[model samples]
Target chain A: MKILVCVKRVPDPETVIKLTPEGASIVTDNVKWVINPFDEIAIEEALRIKEKAAGTEVVLLSIGQKTAQEQLRTGLAMGADRAILVLTDQVVEPLAVARVIEKLVGTEKPELILMGKQAIDDDSNCAGQMVAELLGWPQATFASKVVLGGDQKGAQVTREVDGGLETLAIPLPAVVTADLRLNEPRYASLPGIMKARKKELKEIPLAELGVDVAPRTRIVKLETPPKRTGGRKVGSVQELVQVLHDEAKVI
Target chain B: MIEWSEQHELIRQTFRRFVEAEIKPNLRELEHGDTPPYAILRKLMATFGIDQVARARFERQIAREKEGEAGPGERAAGPEAADSAAMQLIPVIELCRYCPGMVTALGVSVGLTAAAIMSRGTLRQKERWALPLLTLETIGAWAITEPGSGSDAFGGMKSTARRDGDGGYVLNGSKTFITNGPYADTIVFICKLDEGNEPRERKVLTFVLDKDLPGLTRSRPMLKMGLHSSPTGELFLEDVRVGRERLLGETEDVPARAGAKQTFSQERAGVPAMALGIVSQCLELSVDYARTRVQFGRPIGEFQLIQLKLARMEVARMNLQNLIFRQIEMAGAGKRMTLAEASAAKLYAAQTAMDVALEAVQLFGGNGYMAEFQVEQLCRDAKVLQIYAGTDEIQVSQIARSLLRG
Candidate 1:
């Protein structure tokens, strides 16, 4: 069995982000990049599956600039067997990313495709579904639980819904987008990091992928959210209620 | 020129994540509560595959020794030596930021005890004892410092090993302020051979002893001014009989002084990284406190006095970082620090850590004195750096002696 996991490189969530002079994009200088938190979950799920099933190869796929290899290497270090990085300096849109993944799926022929429900950087949350639609494969999004069937030909996935979890039994060669509670991802051990350098990380130029590598949307402007004012201490519960009712007008 | 590369930075980040998730939450228990740091240290080893690396390195070195090759120097000075040094020091720095005591405990176990054996122990001894210590599968204590022999470790030493009639020896010593002493599974006990000579004239011999050896008793952890996370204790051995196999290198002719001096150099060189952690943490805390701490209608950062403290901290941090970089660069060039050079670096680093921590506390004013503030803890922790691996006074003398030697 083969599991293909999609990952994205994003700025570390803890980093203090600064916007460019024109508010066009974030200042990339000095920013540390990491595998998207959700994507880490995806990789963790795939590795877990690989551990349980014999001869299961876990492959990590990422579509980004050459720098994204760091994220791919990180995934490989976390026990992914290999990686395929679709290299492009340009910002590929969700549909374009899906198309590229769809094309790779044809040649790679992985039995299962796993991805994060959304990339934390953009939070578009649509790429996995788009890939599923393009490939005409069943997909279980927001996967909180995944149990492989006895014969390994299918999986029972539990999705985190609005107020409850919904279970779906998806056939083989399915797409599964991981949710937050799937499992805590493991850090890349030192030996794993050393071995990752030797792991096969194959990179393909975006032009060779033969997908429409153009952005379908545009960002007109970006602005930092307004700073939150400090909250005042209320003397009593009644006073707090009165203040909230008068000032916030929502109580 | 030798800054952290992109890969190093990523490794640092990953280690930071591990520290945050594992060590940070249990810090209170480890520091103030009755928890020994071994479990967490083991987790760290397992998480980072440090034990595996140690095991592999140990096997390779032992294999070479078995083939009659000269035992490798303290570290392999190869292309990866610098990176390996960086790898070793990164954890020390990161651990020191929160718990300098943990670093002390870990260093004593792996760096001193295991290293003592690896450098001098015979091939069989290395396989029997040093391997476990290197992997931290067994905790180790290098017992050298006695209660009365802090400065005069050899001259005032009363510990002795007498040649018994059975071709074995009777070991008797009480080691004080021994790191990992309370719970060490393996102990490298250093004593002088008693050929009925003066203590000063006795040969300094080292032996590897098990914790369960009869007549050997370990005391409970001692209360200290700081660095409580690392358990320090005393070891009492009364007529403990051991065979020749327990003797490191199975010979009394091993240059014990030179061997110990090499270990001292390594320990001293590591101080800059530890000091960097403490000093950098203090500086960062001070800077943050200065920026937001309001006094006299402005942030305290607006005041020149606070600015001076912050600037001095920055200077110390930069110097310590450069010292560490120099150490790494030297290792890359297959060079090891002489005891005097290491002493100089340690002296500066230890003093700088102490000073910066003090200033950080001062900058926090009343809050710094309170235990809730981290600088207060750091201030206490920073003092030990100057005292251990030889005191500041000792370091100064070491450096001076090197300069004046004719």
Candidate 2:
């Protein structure tokens, strides 16, 4: 069995983001980049699959500048067999990313494509669906539980839905997008990191993928969310109820 | 000036996350709930594959020792060794930021005890005792300090290991302030050889003893001002008989006295990283408190005195960081600090950490003094740095003596 997990490097969620001087993008000078949290779950799921199925090859696939190699190495440390970096600094939109991944699918020929439902950076929630559409393959998005079938030809996937879970048995060569409730990722051990330094990390230029690589969207501006005002304390239950009923209108 | 590369930063971040996840939640249990730190420390070792690395390193050392080769030098050398050393210390620094006691307990078991056997013990001894210790499969205590011998370990020593009628040694002594003492499965007891020599110039011998041997008694943990997470206790040996095989080198020629100095040097060298952790945490908390603590219609940061305190904390942090970087760079160059140099590093780093922590408490006012605040714990923990391994006064004396001799 072969699994290809698409990962992204994003600014650490703990960082206090600040806008650039132009207010059109975030300031990246001192920002720490980490493997997207959801992507870590995807990697964890892939590792679990590899553990269950003998001779399974888990390859990490990412699209970004050279710095993304750090995230790739981190994935490798988490027990991926190898890594592929689609090297480019251009802001590739969801469609272009899906196209590039589509090109990789043709070469890697992995039986399953595993990835986070969306990267936390843009939260577009479009790339996986777009790739699934481009490839015309079935996809199970927001997967909370995935159990490979005994037959090795299909997998039972439980997905997080509105107020409930939806289960589906998807055949091989499907896309599974990880949800927050997916298996918790393990810490990359020190020995694993040292071994990862020796693993194979193959870099392919975006142009070599033979894709259009053009963005279909652009950001007009970036602004901070409005600051929340301090809440007022009511002296009595009646006063609290009156405030919630009249001023807040949410009794 | 040296800095962490991308790889080093990644390692630091990995350990930082592990600390936040594993240690932060159980901190209260460890600090005040009578829970020992060994279990958590072992879990950390397994989680990080430190045990695997340590086992492999020991195997290599064992093979080398069998081939009549010298062990690897104490100092790290080359980029690989330096990186490996830094990786080991990252957890020490990160853990100390939240709980210095964990690092203390871990260092004694793995660093001090394992290094003791690996460096001086014969191959058979290493296989019997050191391997388990390095892997943290068994806890170890290196007992050198006696109730009477705090600063003058040799001159004021009272413990003795005498040759008995059966050609074995009978050990008699008590060791206090022993790390991992209460729960140590194996102990490396250091004592003077009672060979009819003058007390001050007696030969120092090291014996490896198990926990429950006849006449060996370990006290329950004593109340400590800090480092409570690391159980500190006393060990009393009343004529505990041990065979020649139990001797560290199976000979008295390998003086335990010399090994204790080397161990002290290693311990002193590690102080900077621990100090850096505590100082940096204190500074960070102080900065956050300054920015939000309102007084006289403005944040306390607006006041010049508070600003000065914050500024000094920053200075101390910078200097400590640079000192640690220098140590790493030196290790990369395959250089080890002289005993005096290590002492100087410990002295300055310990003093700086103590000053910064005291100022942090002052900045927090009553809140800082209370147990609720982290700086209060940090302040108490930082004081041990000045006392243990060697006191600030001892470190100063060591540095001055080297200068005077030169």
TM-score of each: 0.91, 0.92
Model 2 alpha-carbon miss at residue A124, Å: 3.6
Model 1: how far is B39 from its true place, Å? 0.8
Query: For each candidate, what is the lDDT?
Result: 0.90, 0.90
Candidate 1 C-alpha lDDT tens digits along A30-85? 89899999999999999998888889999999988989988998898889999999
Expressed as tens digits, the lDDT of each residue in A1-251 for candidate 2 is 88999999999998889998888889998788999999999999999988888999999999999999999988888789999999998988889989988999999999999999999988999888988899998899999999998877898999999999999998988999999999899889888887788899999999887899877677999989998999888899999999999998997
Off by over 4 Å in 1: A15-32, A87-92, A149-152, A162-165, A200-210, A213-251, B74-76
CA lDDT for candidate 1: 0.90
- What lDDT does candidate 1 reach at residue B86? 84
Residue-level lDDT tens digits of model 1 in B328-405 = 888888888888999999999999999999999999999999877788888999999999999999999999999999
Clashes of 1: 0
Top-DockQ candidate index? 2
Q: Which ranges in model 2 have alpha carbons more than 4 Å from their true place?
A: A16-31, A87-92, A149-152, A162-165, A202-251, B72-76
Q: Write candidate 2's Cα lDDT for B1-406 as tens digits.
A: 2677766776788888998888888888888837899888988899888899989988887787668777756444688867776887778889998999999999998889988988888888889999999999999999989999999888898999899968799999999999999999999989999988899888888889999999999999988888778889999999899999998899879967789899999999999999999988898899889988999999999999999999999998889888888877777888889999999999999999899999999999999998778898888889999999999999999999999998
